[model samples]
Each structure stands twice: as C-alpha cells, then as structure tokens.
Target: MKFFSKRELIILTLLFVLSFVPVVGGAIRILEIAGGPSVAPDNPRISNDPFPALLHLLGAIPFCILGAFQFMPSLRRYAPKWHRLNGRIVAFSGIVAAISGLWMTNYYALSIEIQGDLLYVVRMVLGTAMVLFIVRGVAAIRGRKISQHHASMTRAYAIGQGAATQTLMGLIWIALLREEPTGLMRDIMMTSAWVINLTLAEWIIRKTNNLSVSGSVS
Candidate 1:
C-alpha cells in the first residue's frame, strides 16, 4: 500500500498527534504533583533515579524522531541505516526503562491497588524480548538478510515505540469497559499495538522485496 496516499497520511498523522497528547499530559501531571518540570512517574524511587531518568529522556527522543521518519519520504530512503541505529538506541534505553519501571511497579505493589508483581514480570519479559528482537534484527542485517532484518527490526520497533498505544488503549478500555482489563494495561497496550504495527510492517517489508533470501530460496 502507498503510505503517502491521502488516507494513509491522515491515519499516520492522527497517530502521531495522539502520541503527543499523553506525553504532554504526563508532563503536566508530573509538574502538578511535584511543583516542578518533570515527567516522573508517581514513584519515589523513580523520582530520585538519575539513571532511569536519563534513559527515559534518551529513549523518548529516538522514538519520536524515528517514528516521524516513518512518515517522511526524504528520510524513508535511509531506512536501513536508521533502522539499525534506532534499534540500538531503543534496545539500550528499553533496558533502562524496564529496570527503572520495575522499581516503580514495586512501589505500586505496596499501595495495594495494583498487582505489582504481575506487572513487574510482564515488564521484565517485554523488555527482554525487545532487546533480543533488536539484537537479532541487527544480526540479520549484518548477514545481509534484508527481509528478516526488516521484519525483525519492525517488530522490535513497534513494541519499543508502543508507549502511546499502550497508554491510550489502557485508558480507553478501562474507561469504556469498567473492567480490570485482563493483564496490565501496559502489556496489553504494548502487545496489541505491536501486533497491529508489525502486521502492517510485514506487508510493507514483503512489498519492498526485503524478505530474507533464505525464505525465498525455499
């Protein structure tokens, strides 16, 4: 499909706009809570964590930049290079986010409103998977297997960049269903968002004739 086509452009624009709102909202919430300019989560440990804070800051930048590139024709031509670089950035930053997020989840556990243990496990798993996916994607690219590399990188990027979709769906499902929503909202949001993104990415990867030669050989 033509991503630059009118309808695709509109959809992509909508998603990008949706992504912006939560970051702003979270920043405002942080300021209100701390009387400071920050995007700290409601966890004391996290508020005090310099390492994780740095990671989150770095991670968010690449996510926004690379995500924007997905829509820009000029930048799309540099896909292979950007894909590899973004994968490394996201993988490293994801590790920091997950580790720091675990502390926050523990704090939530103490509050008794959320199941911190479950969320912690899920976060750890997702983080590990994301890192592995990126590394493997890099390996595929290095081996000159563009198809596998593209598919794997796309999957990794989708999940890594899922912060917006995860948050939105988590809130939307909670608001509409009034149910606890199976699994943590973050996990569901991340997984569901990635599923959609990877599905579309897969189609594009195939169309670009970037699939691994090994697959085509068989």
Candidate 2:
C-alpha cells in the first residue's frame, strides 16, 4: 500500500516546504556562531550566548521536519514501531526547543525595539504551552489514549512551526506595508503567526476527530 494518499502527500510536501526557509536560516546561524569571530555586530545577542539558540535550532529543525510525518495516518497505521520511535524523538526535540526558546527569551539581552514586551510575553506563554503539550502527549500515549496523544502532539507541532509561519507573516507584512515591521507592529505580526497556526491546528484536530467518529458510526 502507498504510504500516503495523494492529498496526504501534498500536505506533507507543503509542510516540508514551509520548514525549508527556517531550517536554512538556522543552519546559517549555526555556521556563523561556530565559524565566525566573537562579537557578531549584526546579532550580538546570539554571538554572546549562542548555547540556547543553538539548542533551540537543533531541536526545532528535527521537530518541525520529522514531526510532520507523524500526521500521516497511513504511515502510523502501517509502521507502528516507526511511529512510536519517531514520536519519542519529536517529543524530546519539542521539549528542548521550548525550554531553550524560553531561556533565550528570558535571559537574552535583546533590546525592546527588536523584541517588545508583548512579544516577550507571547514567546514565554507559547514556549511553555509547547512543553506542556509534549508532556501531555507522551502521558496520553502511555495511557493508551490515542486521540488525546494525537491532539496534544498536533498542538505542540503547531507551536513548533511558528517560525515558518512567522517567515510567511514577515513576507506579507513587507509586501503590504512596503517596510519591515518594528516594535509593536513586529510583535503583532509574530503573535498573529502563532495564533494562525494554533487556530488551524485546532480546526484540523476537530475535523479529524469528527471524521473518525463518523467513520466508526457508519
């Protein structure tokens, strides 16, 4: 049997494409930190304390890419062992990403112009939510509550993909306004990306659950 239906394959393709820009950006940042001289003038915060950023990038890259596959029902049904193993990796990477993100948000010496108060609070809340969602997903899987596990993991992955959505939002803001957003506008743009992703995630979860119920009933 095919691993994914045509529609599933298209969705997976879109997910990977969304991750491409962020993954490449993270790779370039990693290279800059590892190879360049100390005190990067362009991004002093990352140059000064690269550990958290590195951790977040490493975790987020895998979580975003590999976690996308977990949404494939055919793959999960056919390859249960792979699903379980990949799910573990996804959970661990998600937790690491969330913790590192929170750490950087709290401790990094970012100026208010780059990261306003609202953005700071939003990051903290979303990062904490991602970690909790991953933990709950694992607990639900352990309890054999497959639906809960799927929902929690789906929410966590949605939060994890915020970077991708942020990129899209940034492009839209630039195209529409003819200038990059800053300060409060930037915060709103970034927060709106997360909000959009979570809203879609919730909708997908509900739709999937409804479909499952209808399938069983029929």
The numbered model that scores best in TM-score is: 2
lDDT of 2 by residue, 148-211 (tens): 9889999999999999999988888899989988999899989999999999999988988998
In terms of lDDT, the best-performing candidate is 2
Candidate 2 TM-score, true structure as reference: 0.94
TM-score of 1: 0.62
In model 1, where is the ten-residue run with the lowest total lDDT?
Answer: 107-116
What TM-score, over all chains together, does every model reach? 0.62, 0.94
lDDT of each: 0.57, 0.89
Off by over 4 Å in 2: 36-41, 216-218
When summed lDDT is taken over every stretch of 10 residues in candidate 2, the lowest stretch is 36-45
Candidate 1 displacement at residue 69 in angstroms: 1.6
Clashes per candidate, residues 3 or more apart or on different chains: 3, 0
